[model samples]
Target chain A: MKRFAFFPGCLIPARYPAMEFAIRQVLPRLGIEIVDLEGSSCCPDPIYFKSKDKLSWLAVAARNLSLAEDLGLDVVTNCSGCTATLSEAIHLLEDDILKKKVNDRLGRIGREYKGTTRVRHIATVVRDEVGYERVRESVVRPLEGLKVAIHYGCHLLKPSKIMQVDNPDNPQVMERLVEALGATAIRHRNWYLCCGKACQTEDIPMNMMHDLLTTVKAAETDILGMICPTCFSQFDYGQMKISKKFDEVFDIPPVYYFQLLAFAQGIPYEKLGFDSQRFKPECLLRF
Target chain B: MPEDADRDEPVRVNFRFRRELAQKIEGNLASFCYQCGACVGDCPATTYSSGFNPREIMLKVLYGLEDELLGSESVLWQCTNCYNCHERCPQEVKPVEVIISLKNMLAARGIYPEVVSKIIGTFETTGRTVRITSAIDRQRAKFGLPPLPPVPMDEVRILLEPDTGTDEEE
Candidate 1:
């Protein structure tokens, strides 16, 4: 099995444990190993620049990355928030001047960032390491009839410098990955739209909720496939509020494209972590 | 934003307007504002609502007024995350994402409109961007979903594969 450090970030385990369960059971069959980074905390949620605590943000990011680096392996993450923050830190710390400043602060915690490690999003690993041909070969059940909407959450694509996995304007890697599992990737109005995933705040979210739903409803697809936990939450649970606010019903359920890969692997839906998604058990039937 | 009484010298934020913001819109128009009347002359937001001006925001962001740049309330946020400015820009700037980055930066700072934080907190806690109730119950409601799945406890080690960080004895 291909083994690497796994950072589930705060949400997947806390809010969406089923995704972790599915990942653990499924990735191994694909020749992947996800070692956990013990004692990891929040990605501290990348908005810390406004908070103006670069020291604290770096400390938190270093602490998390240290868990993986100390483990002697680079880190992999499923959440775009975690991936972006972690990778951005890696980029920052890679510079000698910034590294010295961040290291001076991190030294207080007895951690050192050697900068030899990289933080990778799961999609990049799958696309780069596992290869699409391998994914196609591993599929035991193809979702031939399932129509999927792919959400490339901003963090993964934006500033495209750090997370340069696919084309931001026109991305087909995730959709292609979905197609590998026998599912159809649908092009929607909001395919490139932001669900306001990381921009979370009460007044901001409540006010922005309308736009969030407007984009989701505009997609008009059955399964909204996401690769990041932040996007997953916004796209998945935000739907609940959107449905209520707009007074419409959507059977759309959120699924990590990989989870569907597991489902296609003949892994029981129960084992693949489908139960915990926001809408319901039957919601996936539309797929 | 300053308090009522303790007025201090003008504090400058040492930052640059994210190039992605201005280039994505018309005002920064390649960061070469160059007195282009096209922006001031062609803005619909300014024309329709006397208060809205993408040109001003773009100029400020391009000039590197990072704080004053991001400090606007609904101007950038109210910008609709639209690429209209980019399309109209004579110089071709995609300020939409830059505006988004600024908004996200605000949300990150907790300076955003109130609801943005609440929903974000839910995301920080539950791995969701916006959630009303815990999702574990939703899973329980599923008849054919995973059975006896471990509902993750916040304190439980979610990143629990063996850490290579520990010093192993030779």
Candidate 2:
């Protein structure tokens, strides 16, 4: 079994322990050993923190990367935002000039970035490291006949050169993972757009979520699958907010891909955090 | 036109686009953009708000319109950092990186969105953007997971603040 230092970032532990629960339960079964990353700060949020302070962003990320490097394990994260921040930092710091500048900052903390480690999102880790065939063999409850529409959170797939996860335009990694669980992965209109979580300003995130949920509801999707916790919260919870704001009913349960995977692998229902889910995932129990 | 002369201040294109912005992002990918408008065509932000266009921003960057770019209030924030434009751009100019560089410039001047400041402040203090609530703690305990490890705040502060030694050298 391959081992990794799990970087859950700020969201999962703070907002959604259920994602952590699902990840912990599922990754081990797939033959990937997960270790806790102590003393890690936020991926510090790529769009917000990087926008506000570039030097601090690089230094913070380099520190986290070095933590995993010290452990001699590559980093694996469930949050797409963390994946984006750390991976982009790693890619950016490759430049000798920027590396020197960030290292100058790191020197104050007495740490250095050797850039030896690699960062992978949990979904990518599962698909690449565990292999989809092994995932298929492990599924006890094939999510047969369930139609899942994937929100491939922008961070996981974009700036294709840096992320290198899949074809950015025609992404099939999440769909393949969904299929391995015996669900039919369906495509929706707004599948590729940002969850608008980055636009933390006024009505934009709500407006964007409204558009995405409306489109997915129209497409007759059973569940919205996401690899990012922020996207999970946005759609899973944002739909309710959007419904109240627009005065329309939207009852789509947004399930994190790992939660769905754990469920399909028959890791009990209660552990999946279904009750806390805004749209109760009781429907999936029928399968 | 002559009657409105008092209302229109002289168009000052004095602000040159910082070549440093281009260098910071992908090492000169911004200069390779030939203004194909592919990024504009794929941009969702541009679709919703017609005022925000990635192609136009790139043109401004190419033309050294730093004043024009920074003067665009909330226009830079309109980009969701989706990277759709980055993916679609044939020239591989990751416009999102340039957008961020612009935001960093504005942030350095204390001119970013209020929400960004609030979130960053939360990170600076708490090490996480979201505060740990009793409800979150209860949830973790119920799930049988150990409490979250204490944030390395001393190290976080050192990283967030400018290095004193570097400043002294400067």
Q: Output the lDDT of residue B9, model 2.
A: 70
Q: Which candidate number would show the highest TM-score if scored against the true structure? A: 2
Candidate 2 reaches a DockQ of 0.62
How far residue A78's Cα lies from its native spot in candidate 2, in Å, is 0.4
Global lDDT of model 2: 0.82
- Individual DockQ of the candidates? 0.08, 0.62
Among all windows of 10 consecutive residues in model 2 chain B, the one with the lowest summed lDDT is B11-20
Query: How much does each candidate deviate from the true structure in C-alpha RMSD?
Result: 9.5, 3.3
lDDT of each: 0.60, 0.82
lDDT of 1: 0.60
| Candidate 2 deviant stretches above 4 angstroms | A201-203, B1-29, B63-67, B163-170
Top candidate on DockQ is: 2
Cα-based TM-score, every candidate: 0.69, 0.92
Candidate 2 residues A128-153, lDDT tens each? 89999999998999988999988898
Q: Which docking band does candidate 2 fall into?
A: medium
